[model samples]
Target: MTTVTLPEKTPAHTGRTPGRPGRRGVQPLALNIVALAAGLGGWALLSLLGFEDLPGPAQVAARGGEMIADGTLLDDVAASLRRVFSGFALGTLLAIPVGFLMGWYGVARGLIEPYVQFFRTIPPLAVIPLAIVLLGIGETPKIFVIFLAAFLSSVVATYQGVIDVDKTLINAARVLGASDLTVFVKVVIPASAPFILVGMRIGLGSAWGTLVAAELIAAQEGLGFRMQQAQLYYDLSTIFVGLITIGLLGLAMDRLLLLAERRLTGWQERR
Candidate 1:
């Protein structure tokens, strides 16, 4: 009875770690809520401290209620949302292909990067006058300014992503007899997607700022226009309402993009 040898093996994953399933999520949200409350408290305190022109959260909420009652808030929200979406879509759609090309091809990069960098140095607001002159003081100007904002912010990010892709992966594809287009479509795009999403997020912020400037100078409606009108009469509550509305809108949009980024780039890991 030669009992040779017995081996004991340990399992890799024993059991679920308590409170480890997306635990990071709740803490940040809790912290954010705390921070928000503190910020509101501070603002209220300051308003009470002889800041006669400053409107606190309650005043802003009341103004918001009035705007909602009159339906101006709803109309302004819809109009601003439409402009942001349309312009952002147009800019991103164009930026992707152009960025991809510039990143992939040396000739394209050489020819296009100068113009891209030059135009990016010019503030989106700087182009408003030119856009207005050429496209007229209509939806076209507003949309064009937003488009420029998104385009400039995103292009560099897109190019950087493509450029930063692992050279080894590209070489491996080539060794496996993959064509240039096949390598780009199958490998490069997927690898660079995270960078593209970051670019898009930045572009979205730029779009909002540019849209507000355009609206302030020319438009008759939207949140920017509403704020401008409020400013005329020194209506602090209304001004506060407009500011908060813009902040909320931008934050919501950013969060939506962040969700999309997580879904789209699930292969990437975060700490």
Candidate 2:
């Protein structure tokens, strides 16, 4: 008998495990910090150059600090946050079901799509006058306008998401003995979740954008109201402070939605 030798087998590749992010995750955060620093540097450079009217980051920071000390900033923040949250919540709650109806049923789509499109064509700002005229110049008008902004954005996105879901998946679910409700709950909703979340994010941005105009209607205290007041005196520092505050608040809320999206859609693929 002849002696035989076998080659050694190589070990299996050990890649990064699921659910735990790798170095690529930290890279994005670092890049964001770098980009922010560069933006600030650019702003400072502009102020130093010929932009006498513009305030630098340091000046804005000092002005913001003064506002914080005066308790005005806190009140404004609270009021704006209340309106935004209330309006956004109400709009989204109503939008999801309406969007589902329009996308799922033919008759509902025919009746609803026309109005949705019509309202979408009209800017939420344009409704300010009507809102004030009808609802009165109070928190009602402000919240209503914000609700319109959020609702239009969210409903369109949701409707598109539902329509865009792969028809093959629905058919497969039905073939597998799934009922209409089960197919919608298990197949449609999960697939459409990303789109819905994206719509919500867009709606959030719309809400913030509409806020300044909404606050224009007999508003006393809000970031937007504060900015308008500062504008009369050309208080560049205070205006900058308000802008920065709104941007920061919106960024924080968007990040929260992004976190929710990632958690809910973890099974979805990423680049």
**Each candidate's TM vs. the true structure?**
0.90, 0.90
Q: Which candidate wins on TM-score?
A: 2
lDDT of model 1 at residue 65? 99
Candidate 1, 15-58: lDDT as tens digits: 44544662334578788999999999999998888587687788
Residue 147's lDDT within candidate 2 is 97
Q: What do the candidate models score in CA lDDT, each in turn?
A: 0.89, 0.92
Worst 10 residues of 1 by lDDT: 8-17
Task: Give the residue spans of candidate 1 off by over 4 A.
Answer: 1-26
lDDT of 2 by residue, 1-271 (tens): 9999876543333355555654455478799999999999999999888587688888889999999999999999999999998889989999999998988889999999999999999999999989988999889999999999999999999999899999999999999999999999998889989989999999999999999889999899999999999999999898888888889999999999999999999999997
Best-fitting candidate, measured by lDDT? 2
**Which 10-residue window of candidate 2 scores lowest in summed lDDT?**
8-17
Residue 203 of model 1: what lDDT? Answer: 95
